[model samples]
Every structure is written in C-alpha cells, then in structure tokens.
Target: MDRKSLSLLILIVLLGLCIRLQNFGEIFDSRIYYYGYDPYYHMRLVEAIVLEGYRPSFDYYINYPYGLRIDWLPLFDYILAFPGLFLGFWASEIFAVVFPVIIGVLCIVLVYLISLEVLRNEKFALISAFIFSVCPVTVWKSLLGKADHHIWVVFLLLLSIWLVTKPGLLKLLSGIPMLLMALSWLGAPIYAALLAVSSLFQFNEKEVRIVGISNLIPVLSSIQNLFLGFSFLAIAVFLLVGSFVKRFERRFRYAIVYYLCICSVALLSAYLMPVGWLGFVKSGISYVLGTDIYLPTIREARSFQILGVISSAGYLFFVLAIPALFMLRNGFLKVFFVLSFLISILQLRFVEVLAFPVAILASYTICQILERVDYPVFRKEEEGESKRRGRKEKKKAVEIRKKDHATVIAFLLFLALPCFANSLAPVEMTMDWKEALNWMKENLEAQDYLKAYEKPDYAVLSWWDYGNWILYVAKKAVVCNNFQAGADDAAKFFTAQSEEEAMKIVEKRKVRYVVTVEELTVKPETNKTKFIPIMQIAGYSPEYMKNKEIIDFFNKTMLYKLHVENATNLTHFRLLKNFGTVKIFEVK
Candidate 1:
C-alpha cells in the first residue's frame, strides 16, 4: 500500500473504534455496552455457556415456560467463552464491550481490502472504508459490548465477496469463508444462495469446480441436517465428483455446479433430514418478506424514517447502489450486492450488510464528482503537466473546476456529518432502563419462578420488549419475551379494563412483579398516555399501525393513573420500587 493510503487506513480504523467507544469512556465504568434485546440475549447466552454451563434443552430462556426455541448461533458466543469464564458473572458485560468492537475494528480493515480488490484503487478504497467506518448505524450496532452476531455475519460476507474477487484457486477455496458465513448468521444463506447463482453467469468458464468443504471440526451441532451442514455435504459431493471425472471444470455447467450441488443437498435435506430444515428456511425468509406482515419486528415493519441513523446523503448512495450494481454487472459481488440491497430495504437490521457495497458505490459516486471537476485526487495519471496549462486557456472551465473543489469538500463533509452525528446518540439510552432489572435481582430470592412448590416463585410481567433485559440483568423469569404469544399476553395485561383482569393474567403466569416505564404512563391531568413503541416490533408493513391500540390501552383502561398521585385505590397491585422512570408494582 502507498504511504498515504496505509496511514489513512489506520486513521479510519482508529476513528471507527473511537466513535463506537464514544458511548464508553472507561472499562467497567458501569455503562460499557448497550443493554437492549440482542445485546442482552447474547449476554445471557454467553453467561449461561461460560458461567453457568447451562445447556438449554426444551426449556430455554427466551420464550420462557411456553418455550419457543430460538435458533441461537454459537460461533460468536464461543469466541467469548474463555474470557467469560474468567470474568464469571461479569462475563457478558466485559465480552459485550470487547467482541463487537474487536470485530467492528477488523471490519474496517476487511472493508478496505474488499473495496481495494473490487475497485483496484487505493484512493477509492480508502474512501469506501471511511464511509463504512463512520456510518452511524454501523457504528452503533458494532460498538463495544453491543454483542450482536450480525457483525460477524457481515465480516464473513465481506470476506466471501473478497474471495469472489480473487483469482483462480483462491476463488475455488472460497467455500471456506462461505461455510463460516452460513454458520454465523441468518443472512449467510442469502450470501450462499447469491454466490451459487452468480456462478451461473460464468457457467462456460473452462476451469470451474465445486470443491468439498474441509470440515476442521466435526459434530458441530445436534441438527446434522443444518443448512450450514448441508453446505458442507454439498461440498463433499463436489469433491467426490473430482475423483470420478478428473475435472468438473471441463463441463459447460461448471460455473453452476455449486448451485446444483447446494440445491441437491437442500432438496435431499427436505425429503430425508427432517421437516425442521424446511421450516428453518421458511422462517428465515418469512422475516424479510414484507408481505408476511408480522405484528412487530426490529426492522422493516416500521417506516423507513425509523432508520434515521443513516443520513439522507448516505441513504442516497444506498439507493444509488442498485444502479451501481447494474452498471458493474456480470460479477459475483454485483449479484451479492443486488440481492443484499433488495433484502435490506425490507428490514433495517439487514442494512448493515450493505455497508461495504454502499460505501463502495458512494466512493465511486464521489470519485465521479471529483473527476468532473478534474480534481487531482481522482484524476488519472496525466501524460504532461502542460495539460493543465493548455486547459487554462479555457478560463471559464478552469474557474468552474476551481470553484468545484470546495463543492467536493463540502459534499464529502455533508455526507459524513450524519454518520458522526448519529454516532453521538446517547449510549446510555440502551442500558438506562436496566435499573429496574437490577433492583429485582438484588431483591428476588434464588430459585426458578416456575417451581412454586419449592418457594413462592416470582416472575416479572413486563412488555415483551424488555423481557430479554429483565431476564438477562435480573436473572428473573419474565412473563413474556420475544415470543409472540407472550407479547400478546403482555399487551392484554396492560390494556385490560380492570386491575382484577390484569392481575388474573399475571397470577396465572405466576408473575409477582409488573414493570412499566414512566414514559408509558399518562399525564393524570390530560388523561393521555404515550406509546413507548416496542423496539423489535417495529415492522416494515405499510398498514398503519395505530399507536392508539397501546396508548389508549393505558388511557381507556385508566392504567396510566397508576403512576399519578391518588389516581385509584390499589385494588390488586402495590408499588414495589421505582428506579428513575422504571416502576415496579407487586401484584397484590
């Protein structure tokens, strides 16, 4: 790398890490990572695997007693295992801050290398990496202690794309990263599917082959028919072909060989492996299908404005990338970009995967703008210095070019300001609510809530939104978590007309505690309650979601008065503790 490029690369990575650490100033400062759904979910899992040695069976933490088995990918969690053991109970907090930032920082380097391979221009690649490094949502999602697996998924995707950009034998060995990518996240399948399909474009290539995946670790998971496992089995068949035919590359269908192999494995898996394989594929796709229209989700269900973390300028390039791919058609990266972009619009979480391509395309657009002004940074090597002298004869054009230099700089800053601005959003907002959870942990007795015969069991009845946090932070059983039925129950609990009705449901679930954020409460004078929109329930549907359903559930039921003075006599509930805006009420 050139001296300037290498220096800028290091600068971008350092800046990315610093921006992500913007929320954190010191280690063990008590507020290291965001304390929300995915973060807490992973934290609880890491704590279980490392500290408790809690191997989940039919009874898992997420869905609670009703038990919806969340398909948890263990790759990132395994990375935290050893360190978590040393930290003991504090494992999640420490690992949360460390892993994401480490992976995110590495992404800066990976993104730069991937861009360099595609663009073959260090200048453009540096800009691409800069855009990615500073992307507001990217920064927030990839921050230290955030503890989401999507970053690993993104890193694997970029590596796979980078492999696609490689020459010959390297590309053939891409199944290695592809295998890792598929095992890492839900979206990895999309990458595999796209890669397989892209190979169709070059089916006629004379030296194509679908080699077997080298399984370094056997007996990975219980489900032998896992999609990731299927990926390997597909590779095994590919390798077996090499023994029979000397070279599968000589065939016209060589490029599509991987596609056929994966398809065959998938079909075989569906018929013989188990119905879960088909169900898994269906469930994964159902998430992004806008038509599915589930009640609440983290991403697409909400309006596009929900993803305000990404600035309008950044989003403009994100839109530009569709055409950008079409412009650079007939490549593996283009296929992946086009597919990822298509899915991204359906969900905001999926947008992080687009950071590489979005940044790459944005960099190209910036370069194009600079090229128009004949800016030195973007200008191709000139044959003569007199070219500027000759061009100077056109005084008007020279003045226009000079005037545009400021425009280029302005535009660069304009595009960058939002990402940095977004990075500044209060990180405290994530874990601030954990105060309620902490209070419960210190107060609640030690035992599982379902075991009523042993001790008076306790369960926290809160909205499904904070269930993960309550369980993770307080080590208490939550009435509802990510499960849809649990969410429905919580919704009913809050909206019920009478305390007796709300308590009936709470008692049925053995919920000793009912938690509510002060923001969700109404102003006693106004008789109005605000909708604390459920974070994950933010859906991509265009169907107008009436906030009134939840807001009036508080107002119409007079539940808002619970936080106000002398609102109503405690018929069936008693105040336990109030942690700032977070309030806990005991079911009387």
Candidate 2:
C-alpha cells in the first residue's frame, strides 16, 4: 500500500476505535443478555461454551426449570466469548469494542480496493472509505457490545467479493473468512447470493472455468450443510450464466458438469449442519412477506426525521453512481457495483458494507472521467517540433483537471451530508438500569421473590424493557419477559387487553411489585388504544383503576412498602412502589 493509503487506513481504524470504545458499559438492548429472548438467548449459549467448556446443544436450556432452549448461529457470540475465555469479563468487553472496530476498518479498506478498481482514482477511493467509516448507522451497531450480527456479516460479504475479483491463492484463501462469517451471522447467505449473482456479470469464460474448478473441493466438503453448499453452487451458477451470456458456448458444457459436482457435495453438507439452517428460510421469507415472524416494519424501518423527510433519499443519491460504474472497461466491476448497491437497498443494515464497495466504484469512475477529459503530460507527443509547448499545455491542463475533480468530489461529499449528520448521533442509547439492579441485589433476600409487571431477565421487579437483561445479568429466574416464543400462554396473559386477564398473571405469578414506564400507564378513552390499560386513565372510566388503586390493593391485601426508586432527568418514571415504574416492594 502507498503512504496515502496506509495513512487513510490508520485514520479509519482510529476513528472506529474511538466510536466503539465510548460508553461501553451501556446495554443498548436486553438482546445482549444470555437469558434474553431471540438473539440474546443464542448469545448466552456461546457464553456458556466459553465460560463452562459447554458445547451448545438444543438441550442446553432444557435442564432449567424454565426450559429455555439455546438455538441459533453461535459464530458472532463465539467471537465475543473467545475474548472472555482468555481475558475474563473486562477483557471480553474490550474485545467486543475492538472486534467491531476491526470490522469497520476492514470495511473501509475494502471500499478503497473496490473504488480503485472502478474509479481508478486513489483520492476518490479515500473519500468513499472515510464516508463509510464514519456513517452513523454503521457505527452504532458496531460500537454496541451486543448480539447484533450485521457488522460481521457485512465484513465477510466484502471479503468474499474482494476474493472473487482479485483471484489469487490468497484470494482463494478468503473462503475461510467467508465461512467464519457465515457462522457469525445469518446474513451471510444473503451476501453470498448477491456475490454469486454479481460474479456472473463480471467474470470471463476462462476466469469462470478456473473459479468453477477451484471451488469444487470446498463445495463438496460443505455439501452436508445445505446452506454452505448452496453458496458454492450459487457462485458456480453465476459463473456459468456469465460465461454463457458472453457467447462462450464451448465452456457451457464444462460449467454444467462442474455445477453438478458442486450440487452433489452440497447435499451431503446439508445433513451435517442441519440445525444451522433453522429459522433461516422462515425468517427471510417472513421479512420479505412482511409477517409477524420476521422484523416488523416498526422495528426494521426507520421513522421520519424531525423535518418529516425520510432518510432514504441519502441512500438514493449513493445509488446513482451504479450506472457510472459501467463506464469502466471491466464488465466485472460494473456487475459488482450494481450488486452491492442493490443489496444495500434491500436492507438498511447492509448500507455500511455496501457503501464501501459502491464508493470505490464511484471513485474509479470519477478518475476515468478525469483521464478522458484532460490529457496527462505522459500522453503528450514528444517527437514533434511543438512537443515541448504541448507538454507544458498538457501539464497546465492536468492541474486544471485535478482542481475540477476536487470540486466535483466536494459537491458529492456535500450531497452526502445526511450520512455525515446521521453518524454524529449516538446509536445505542438506553436507560441505565444499573442502579435498579444494585438496589435489588443489596436489599432483597435470597428467598424473596420480586414480581415484575413486565418480564425482567433478572430477579429485580420487571419492567418491560429490562426483562431479558435482568435474567441474564442477575442470574436469577424471571416471571415473564420479552421472549414470546418461550413465554407462550403467560406472555399472552401479560399483553392481554382485559384487566382481569392481566390480573390472572399477577395473582398466579405471585408478583409483589408492578413495574411499568410512566408513559405506558395511561388508559386511552378512544378506539386507538383498546389494548389493556396497565394503569387507569383519570377521565376514561369509573371502573378504570389508576396507579393509586394498584398501590392501595398492595398496601391493604399484604404488607407492602416501596423499597427502591430510580428517577432520572429522562421522561421515563422509575418508582419502586406499585404506583410507578416499580423496582421492588416488600410483602410484610
């Protein structure tokens, strides 16, 4: 790498480190807890593996009275857990900080490489790298020490594509990283699909044949695992399609034979890695179909900004550079650029990783345009009488071209203002539940059970948000939490609209304290909020009991007193009594 490239790389790495290291103590979501539902439950399995020498099994959580099962990809959490194995808890946390930073740096570097290939300009590539590195949405997930797998998935996707384009022994060696990435996150399959499709448009007959033959071993080896094998087959199909479309009829037969061999191996690998495939297809389908099983619109889609403008416009501007990629002589770069751009739009999480490669192609295109518009000194004729004069003119022209290029780049950067602005905001802001946890730990006796209005992961009185984390961090059983899959009937009762239905959970669970956020307490008198009113509204109904009613019942029916209160400058209320966001109340 040149000095400029080296400097840029170092600068990006430092920037990533700074962002990821800040506020490491905060839990962005309860999804980080081992016992939490969905993503966190899977993370705990990896933690168990590292801390207790336990291999994750479907039955890992079966022994618990709760019968919580540990299932999902173990790779991302394994990365987090590996550090814990060697460095202990503090070191593990540090590893989480460093892991995302390294991924972010790699993302920048990949963008640079891809940009250099397409734009053929180092300056543009550098700019692209800087923008991607500092992007807010990208930085937010990477910095938070949690079960989020998007960053690692994007990094591997970039590495895989880079390997395909560069093509070397080292490039071939990139499969290991790709496999590791697949293990780390479910998004690997999506990326692999995009790469395979793009590869068809990019590679030539000879290159396709070579890649087809080269990938056979890995494909065969992974056949027992259908998903892994499919990735290989997908790549082969892309190559075959690319070659056939290029009128390389002679190579078509060979490609077909190679493809069949890959398919056979993929079949075998499917059997071996059966569990790894769970929820992959279902989740992907649900997401695309907009179903309850997948990330709902509210969760996956970003809300309108303060000005009521959607943030997608910034993404649209970045996408305009795709057609510019075709200006490059290489068909491969054009296809790759289009693929990366399209994949990015498919999911918001893919934006950062996708941006890097897209930027690289954009930079290269800009460089090519500069080269065509103005002749360089080296291109001037030296044998003619006017050669010296022409050279001087060419030099001046080159200087002008460089200045113009810089101005154009500045405009592009300005257009990227939204991306820069988004990066400035904190990604993973959350309420500090440490005080509440500490209060519960210090005061509550071992035998005493705290009832939470919402399922807390730990033993403290449960608020809806803290349920999963509480369970994981406190190492104590919880009544009800966010795990809809595991909670079954109990979850239904907690979320029910009827007060009698909700009371059934409270009475049956022997919940001593009802914890809820202040904002969630009000009962709606309109049709909009027909859902269960956790707290009564003053003007709604005579039968609608407010916070005071719950408190009165707790005081009269049992020996009850407020044991903790957590107030903050923020809007959320944290009251230990049944009247507010309760932490704990003693039943005397």
Candidate 3:
C-alpha cells in the first residue's frame, strides 16, 4: 500500500513488458519460427489434432526403419493449438508472441512476493523482481514463439516455492498451477523435486507418519503392477522421511492429512485424465538419464559463457547487499537463499533463476548498511538533546527511506544495462543465414528442394532454423533438420554418401535442387573426399586436375560446365539443368 511498494510493482511490470515486447514481430511474422524442425512438426501435429479431434498416433512421427518412437511432451503444443483453432494460424503466431510476455510479467510478480516474504522489505523485494524482469536470457526466450514451455517452467517453479514457504488456503490453490506446470515441459520434474524437498523440510512428524501409512496402502493394493507399486512405495518413503525430519506433532495432524488426501486425489485423477501419462513417464525417465538428447556444442559454449558472466555479476551485487540478509533476521529466508544460490551455481543453464534472489539479498544488505551509518547529529547530541534528536531522527528516517528508494531504483537500472544490450543483439539475429533465407525466398520456387552439404542443426546451417521455413514458404521437405533426436529418416539422409551416391538419392527422392553456402563447403581436408564440391559459394577454393587426357574429357563431357565469373568462389550449378549453375550432368 506504501508509495514505494506501489512504485516498485509498476516498475517491475513495465520492465517485463518492455523486454518481452521488443522484436516480437521477429517471431510472430517470420517463416523462421516455423522453420525450426520441432516447431514445424508440432504445428503440423497440432493442426491435425485440431481438425481430427483426436491425438495423432505415435506411429505418425516414428515411421522410419529404426522403429524408434519419440513421445513428445504435448502440453505446450496443445495449448498453442487451441488458440490456433479459434484465431487461425496467423493470429496464433501473434499469440505466441504475446503469451510469453504475460507469463514473464507473472513471474516477476511472483519473484517479488517470494522476496518480500524472505527479505521483509518492500524495496528489496522490488529489486529482486527488477533483476528477474530484465535478465537477457529470460527476455530473449520469452520473445520467441517456441519459449512457451520454458517460461512456464520457470514461473511454476517460483510459484511452487512461494506456496511451500507461505502455506495458506490461497497457497493450496497453487497446486492447480503446479499441475499445469508439470504438463508444460520435460524439465518439470526437476522443479517438482525442489518443491518436494522444500516442503519436506517444513512438515511435522506425527502428520508425516499418518501420511506415510496412507501412502503405503496404495502400494500394498497395487503390488502386482511393479512400476506403479514401486512409485507408490517411493512416495511413502518420502512422506516418512519428511515427517521424521520435521518432527511431526499431533497438533498439526489434520493439516498433514488434508495435504495427503489432496495428493492422493491428484494421483487418482492423473490416472483417469487421458493425457498420455504412460508416454510422459517413459519420456521423463529417458530425459533424466540423458538418452536421445541433444547437448550444446562448442559454438553454443560462447553464448553460455556470455549468459554465465552476466548472471555471476548479478550474484556479486547480491553479495554486496549481504548486510540486508542479516538485518532481515529470518532463519528460513537465509536457508532458502543459500540453498537456491548453491543450486543455481551447480547448473549453468539455471543462472537466470538466481538473479531474483541475488538482487533481493543485495538490496537488503544495502538498506541495512545505510541504516547503521553513524550520523554526526546522533554523535553530538547530549542526553536531553539525544531525546529531542530521537524524535527528529524518526522524522529523518522517513525522509531517508524515500531518498534510498531512488538509490535502489538507480542500482537496478545499472544492473539491467547488460540485459538491454543483449536484447538488441540476440545471437540468432546476427547470423549470415538470415540473408540467405531472404535470397532463397526471392529466387526459389515452392517445389524446389534444397540439399545442404553441411549438417544444418550445428548452428552453421541449423536445421531447426530453416527447415520449417522451407516447408512453409518453399513447400519443400528438407533432407534433414534438428528434429534429429527422433527424425531417423533425416539422420540417415545426412550420413548417406557423396555427390555420386547423392545422385541416386536425388533421383529416388525426386530432389530438384541443392543449396550450398560458405560454411557448409569449407570443411577440413580430411572431409574433402567425403563431399564432392558441386557448387562454390563465398568461402571455397577448388583444386584443378590437369592432364591432356583429363582436359579432353572435360571438353567432351556434357556433365561439367562453369557457371560463374569467379572460378574460386560463388558458383552454382545443376546436374540436369545445363542452362543454370549445373556443374555436372548425370545421364538419367
């Protein structure tokens, strides 16, 4: 209700909006949004689901020879499909642009709530909220169409933390959101683990024993179903351990019972929900064990390093605010802050999650340090004067609080400078292929196929980046894309063979065109034999083989011809179309 708190809330909301709204058009209007192979696949599947009013069979995505069934998590695509059904595809694209911004703002508000409980200072809470709102990685992800699941994961994780720390009638309502969060992404279980741990520490002993007994009943009832039975047993163990640790007592037994009943109801409902629980269980286990996963490569390491440095700087600012942590004097807050900090550092991808906590701790530390400063007026006053000065001090404290509010605002703005810079220069926007995509749209027809020499998903010619655009704009099927984890056909296409062997593939697949860029052709000397140079682009050099016999063959052959003025670079050719950039001909 205070002026400062109201101002801070407005500031956090505005910061979230500004970061999320920037370049929203980039995602909403571009073919690139659809080009990413997974998004493309999801869009197609969602469209089918909407039209058919039924989930597609798993066989639809797993028709390759390998017989691998990829069970994709469906919550995000399903949510997207609903809007698409009402608004149609274009409006749905716009929805993707705005949805994450709304979620990001909610996340900011939740962070403030969590911080206020921990720091007990409105100013410190606002600082934490500001830090989260402007984090570059958070902002960047929120702007993209594909960011729905990631933002939901972060928001739900924070909401769960708030619920565990503050438990009330309202907090119990947090479970609805938690269920949605669990459905949102493969990473949901990690957040669940954190929540369960936090909740375990807060539970009492007698309540735990009752819950443990109740959980065991289900296990005993389903002992014949090994997996299901074991899962129930594990829940029972967790309940017992949690209850014992917190020393559960008779006074709180009813609360514990209510909590267990809610969980049991949730479990029963999950079994009957028709939400592909079995598929989720299988995929979730596979994800945890790191099977069939794609990891960041050396090129991706550069972006990670940038994100890491920015996050670490935010933590440093928080450490500088150490005095506030001590001044707040909340034992639970201290434990949560320390544990969250350690967990954030342990995982590189999670650095953004630490920003809010660090900022709050830092703000609290700063406020406490300011409060303890030795003013000359206090030191010089006599006993009577001290009493008079004490009254004056109360009035002065009000003024100082107002002035320090501005200082906190300024400090947050300083912390957000890095994020602002990053927002303007996203790693994806600066790549050369954005230009290549433009060129292809102008020159190529809907039916022309593109055979890329390099593996596109490697950031050089990332399959995810262009695959959907090719499908949407060019109406072409890519030889391969980033859906490599589950795209067995695409994976096979990449490993198949040289241009001579590719000729057979092209004929069999009825491929009409091949596209090669600088990055794809400039490989190591060892890979040269594996790839025959069909076209030379900006960054290539070809060695000439000269002999009277070879010269005679070149002159006599209809297959070989030069298409460009520059022999060393920028040549395009077709094997059959001798009029174009066709470098060689195959007698079809």
Candidate 4:
C-alpha cells in the first residue's frame, strides 16, 4: 500500500472510532449494567469461564434444576481470557466495550483491500473503506458494551474473502479465517455454500478437495460440538492441498469427481451422526423464514424493507450497492454478495455480512463516477507526470491532494450527516433494572430455599426478555430467558385469566419470585399499553390483552410496575420489595 492510501485508511478508521463513540455517555454510568440485555448473558458466561473456571454444559442458572447448557460458541468467551485474567473485572469490562470497536475499525482495512484486489482501482477501495467506516448499523453494534460475537463474525468473514482473493501462497490462508468463523459463530456454513456456488464456475479441483477434507473433520466429532479440532486440521489441509492443486489437475475430470465424492461422503457422515446436524439447518430456516411460530415476532428475524427507514438504515446505500453488484467483474464476489443480499431480505440481521459487499459496490460506483468527471487527485502539473509514473512503478507514495480532494471532503460530509442522524442512540441503561438486580443479588437466599434433595434451587418468574439479565445480575435461576425457551407459557402465565392458572406455571417451574418492569407500560389507570411488540413475541395479541373484557384481568397481573407503590398484593401475590419501576412479588 502507498503512503497516501495508508494515510487515508488511518483517517477513515479514526472516523469509525469517533462514530462508535456516539453513545459514550450511556456506557460509563455506574447505575447501568450494560447497554443491551444479551451482552449481560455473554458477560456472565465470560465471568464464569474466567473467575470460576466454569465450562459450558455445567451452567446451573438459566434452566434451573435441570441445569443449563448455553448454545453459544465458546471461543468468544475464551477470547475474553486476556483482559479478564490480567486487568481484573474492570479491565475485562473495558475490553468487552473496546475490543469490538477496535475490530470494527480494522475491518475497514480488509474491505478496502478486498475492493482494491477485485476492482483493481485504489480509488474504489478507498471510497468503500470510507463508506464502511461510517455505516450506521456497523457503528451501532460496535460500540462499547455492545460486545456480541457479531463484530468478530464480520471480521472473520471479510478476512476469509480477502484471503481467498490473494494470489499464490496467500490464497491458502483463506481456510484459517473460515475455521475461525466456525469456532465463533453459527453462520460459518455460509462460507461453504458460497464456495460451493462460486466453484461451479471457477472450479479448482484441488482446492475443492482440500475444502472437502476440511469439512470431514467436523463429521468425525460429535454433532453439536464446536469444530475446534477440525478447524486446526483444516489449516494444514489447505496448506498441503494448495501446494498440490496444479499437480493433481492433469486429469481434471477425475479430480473433480474425487472432490465431489469426498464432499458427498463427509456430508453423509455429518447427517448420519447420532446427534443431528440437521437441527441447525432446520433452525436456520425456522429463524429466517419464520416457518415456525417462534420467529415472526423477533425484530432481527424480520426482512429489511426498503421503505422501512430505520429497518433499512438508509436505502441510498442499497440503491448504490445493487448497481455495483452487477458492475463487479469478480465471479466469487458477485455470487456471494447476491446470496448475502437475498439472505438479508429474509432476515435483517444478515446486514452485518451484507455490509462488506454493499460498501464495496456503493463506493466503487461513486469513485468511478468521480474519476470520470475529471476529478483526479494527483495533477500532473503539481506532482510531475514523471514522478507519478515512477511512484506507481515503485508502489511508493504519490501526491493525492491536488484536485479531487475537495470532492472527497464534500462526499464525506454528505455521508456523515445522514449516518450521524440515523445512528441509534446508545442503549441507555435505566436505574430500575439496576436497582432490582442489585436488591436480588444482595437478598436472594444463598442456601437453597427448596429442600428437594436434588440440587436445591429457586427460579425467578419474569418476562423472557428480562430473564437473562435476571440470571446474569441477580445470580439466580429464572424460569425463562431471551433464548425463547418456554416463552409461550411465560406469556400464558402473565396473561392468565385467574391466579390458579398462573400459579400452575409457577408451581410447575419451582418459581419462588416474580419480577416485572414498567419501561413499556402505559399509565396505570387504564392498564392499556401501546408497547405490545414484546407481548407479541410471546405469542399473545395486544388486543387479546387489552380487550375491554380483560382490561381488569390485565391490570391484576401487573406485569410491569411503573412505580414502587404499584407493587401491591393481588390474589396469590404478596408484595415483597419495590424498586420503583422494577418490583418483586412472592407467591403466597
């Protein structure tokens, strides 16, 4: 990379860093735990993995007496080992908030490199890098305390694509990133699908064979286990195969046949395993298409509607991107991006993966237009034509501030203004959530309240959305959580017609305490609410809850206590403690 490009990269990354800091005010508050609820779930797991040496499948919190095995990939928590071990809890907290942002900034580099390699134009690469740096959703998810596995997912994906595009020995490194993706996220299979499709045209028999063998490693292990062992083996497989691809290709048809045979065998083994790999496949379908009743209510599961404003996060990007997809000459990128864009249409969260290609598309087209408009950055009169050619030949620095510099500055302001306005406010943590959680942590019985002879435990009954946070902060078991397990019954319990109906669920689950939040509630007098989106998540209709016949029934349940005084006894529930907006009740 030339010095001019390097300088632009640094400046763009700095801009990304600044954009992510838009919500800095919300994260530092002592009263708030984390910006989002899901982060707490991951953070709690990291805490167990770090301080207690706890491993997956040994968790006793979320699922209560049955014990819980988190479905999350383990590498992310393991990645937290560094800051957690050395700097202590505070330092680990800092890492959770900062690490994703740093990764996010560096992603601009890979996107630029990929655009540069594929388009063969530095202008296109630089513009795409700049666009990526300021993307709203990317910035939103990369902020402090928003530490989900997503940023890592994006980086590993982009890195894999970058490696695949590299010439010679560097191309062998592609599998390493793909392996890392398998270690980190459930979406790793997208790589395999893309390659299979891409290879239809650019079919390198030896490369396909290497990938085929690498896939075999997963088949040998038990299904449902992270493919860590196989991931390591894949690196060596790719290295060896890359060295021999040309040599093995003399009988090209035979080599293709062999590769296909290996892939078929590996796939058959994966399906025949005792544990089902098919469940993951089914779950993906259920999640994206909402074929199962569970997914339609999930905000992330919804499609990105072009006119939905916030859901689309600026349609102009897509308008530019769609055109760029057709304009791209790279066979692999074109097919992969089309697949990614289609997936994003099925579920909006896939935007994380789609951003890389879309940015390249949008930026490349804009850069090409600027180039054609006589907006050259290095003027011959200023830099000397001989020096410019010499710099290009040596791959050295060239003056880039002559003409298009003004256009670059103006274009940046245009993109920045909309991104700034559309940026999501930092998830503000409220005092109510903090207060209730703190109270429970201090007050929950250390000795098992139930003497059931088994692992004596207690479970909190709350809405599923808050249950994960309850488990994380209160350090107590909960009947349901964000994972959507048993959510229908949670909704049923809250919206039950009578106390007897509700107590049946509470008794069945061994629930000792009940918690409620007032954040989404309407004024208490009417017991009516406009905030029913979450209620919809649990498979209950807003009208069903708010019907005139059931308005009294809804008020009696008191799912959210808007004020401390609002936590009062009604039927079987006895008021235990009140933390203003968050209140606790005991089943009597």
Cα lDDT of model 1 by residue, 107-202, tens digit: 888878887776677877887888888876677667766777777777776766666566666765566665565555545555555554444443
Candidate 3 lDDT (Cα, whole model)?
A: 0.48
- Model 2, 6-78: lDDT tens digits are 7866776676566555544444343332211333444445556666666444431221224344444566777
Top candidate when judged by TM-score against the true structure: 4
- What is candidate 4's lDDT per residue for 1-588, written digit by digit as tens? 789878978888888888887667677765435666678777877776667666454455665555555667777777865587766766677788777888888788888888878766676788888878777777766876677888887888788677666665565566666666676666566554555445433435555444444444333232445443443344345434533543565757355446546755764565455566455544544555556565555656666543432334434665677676666566566666677777777777777776676678777667656656656532334347666667444544444564558767787568657766766564445677777787898887763322212354578877777877887777777777777675666776766546677778888878788887665454656653523554565455766554554444455554632122354445667778877767788777
**Candidate 4, residue 63: how far the Cα is off, in Å:** 3.0
Provide the global lDDT of candidate 4 against the true structure: 0.64
Tell me, by lDDT, which candidate is best. Answer: 4
Off by over 4 Å in 4: 199-284, 304-314, 377-404, 426-428, 446-456, 520-569, 576-580
Off by over 4 Å in 1: 25-28, 31-35, 58-64, 67-70, 86-92, 199-228, 231-277, 290-313, 319-330, 377-411, 428-434, 448-456, 483-485, 521-553, 564-567
**Candidate 2 global lDDT:** 0.48
Ranking the candidates on TM-score from highest down gives 4, 1, 2, 3
lDDT per residue (tens digit) for residues 1-588 in model 3: 598578769977886787676665555444535212345555555655555554443421222112223345567777777777776765555565566678878888988888777645565577667776776656654664544466667777677667645634444444445555545544544445444444543444553355444445434323323443455455657666667545433556455445655665765565546676455445434443334424222122122354464444353465564565566555444545555555444444455455555556666665554445531122332335767756444334323455555665575577566657765534343234444455444654433222111112211111233444444343344433444432222222222333344344444434444433232222233343211222111112234533333333332211222212112221222332222321212222
Model 3 spans > 4 angstroms off = 28-42, 50-70, 144-146, 169-171, 202-237, 248-293, 296-347, 369-398, 401-405, 423-465, 468-475, 486-588
TM-score of 2: 0.67
Clashes in model 4: which pairs? none
Tell me the lDDT of model 4 at 189: 62
What are the lDDT figures for the candidates, one per model? 0.59, 0.48, 0.48, 0.64
